[model samples]
Target: MTAAVVTGLGVTAPNGLGTEEFWKATLAGESGLGPVTRFDAAQYPSRIAGEVTGYAAEEHIPSRLMPQTDHMTRLALTAADWALADAGIDTGELPEYGIGVVTSASGGAVEFGQRELQNLWSKGKEYVSAYQSFAWFYAVNTGQISIRHKLRGPSGVLLTEQAGGIDAIGHARRHIRKGFPAVIAGGVDAAICPWGWVPQIASGLMSTVDDPARAYLPFAAEASGYVPGEGGAILLLEDAESAAGRGAEHIYGEIAGYAAT
Candidate 1:
């Protein structure tokens, strides 16, 4: 039997941008929820949300990619980069076909799609950028990460909403069992913009409480609903034998088993 183990982790959450920062803040009982600031949510029923702060895309992403990706995809790419670095894997020396990417997304790229459509309606069809053809796709994150890292093994994306991230990891574990050495798997999502908010609001599952602290009491009887947030995590899943062969310094844990209905 083959074992899939977690070698590295990267996190981009509203509370923090990296794994260390997020962990420290979480242990300190800090929260990132607040009134929406990406746009004016003044007229919306639910105004507060978990928004990633202190991230300037220019600092993390190449200037050439700036015009080709959405905010969510950029975050995904950054997470994947961090995960690989954390694992101490020098992708340049590894076999391209030995690595793969599997990620999940729910909202796709609402902000990018909305902007393109607005351009189409207000200006002309030609005003829309060619990148829109894939920027709004749910699989864009997986594709972009794979391309950026030069990973050429099996790749895919899942869309099970909140469950998608875990599902992606499960799938990646299967890939590892099937002989692949390493796989980048996880999920990152962003849909806090006006266009994205409309559908979420229509779902009737968002908490309407104005107070950031009280808006997301999921386990309490006072729980109205859940608060919408952006960002997530990415992980490096490697076959146990391969990890040992590569002199991996740490093993977070093994994906010993998985089951879902």
Candidate 2:
């Protein structure tokens, strides 16, 4: 049997971008819930969201792939980049075939899909980007991360709605146990746009409260529903032996066990 340990963590949350910053905020009991600014939520029933602030994709994403990816993909890419740095695994020095990527996405790329549809109707089919067909898929993150970092092990994507992120980590552990040196696994999503929100609203699981502070209350008597938000997390899972062989220090934690129904 092989041991799978978590060596790196990357996050893009409504409260923070990096691990340390996010930790501090969490410790302080900070709340990221506020008015939705990504678009006008005034006309919608739910007008608040836990949105990531101060995120500039151009600073984190490669310029070449900027126009080709949606905000969800860019967030995943940024998280992956930071996760690699956190693990001290330089992609250039690692064996191309030793690493892999696995991610989960519930919403796919609603923002990109919405834009493409608008383009087709407002302008023409030619005005729509060729990247939309692939970029809007749920598996785009896994594919993009694998290509950008040259990881060639076993790559895949999981779509289990809210539980998908946790499931991805479990699958990555399975990959490591099966002989892969390491795996990048996690989930991301951004469906706060009009079209995206409509479908989510139809689910009837979202809150319609006008006050951001009192909107999302889980397991509480005041619990109405959830406030939609954008952002996700990424983690680097490596074999314990491989991590020790490379003298990789600063391990955060370990996924000692995992299972799914």
Show how many residue pairs clash in every candidate, following the order shown: 0, 0
lDDT of 1 by residue, 226-246 (tens): 888888999999999989999
Which residue pairs does candidate 1 place in steric collision? none
lDDT of 2 at 116: 96
Off by over 4 Å in 1: none
Q: What are the models' TM-scores?
A: 0.98, 0.97
- Give me the displacement of residue 176 in model 1, in angstroms: 0.5
Q: Score residue 191 of candidate 2 by CA lDDT.
A: 81
Per residue, candidate 2 scores C-alpha lDDT tens digits across 147-216 of 8988898999999988899999999999999998899999999887998888878889999988877898
Error of 1 at 120 (Å): 0.9
Query: What is the alpha-carbon lDDT for the whole of candidate 1?
Result: 0.93
Off by over 4 Å in 2: none
Which candidate tops lDDT? 1
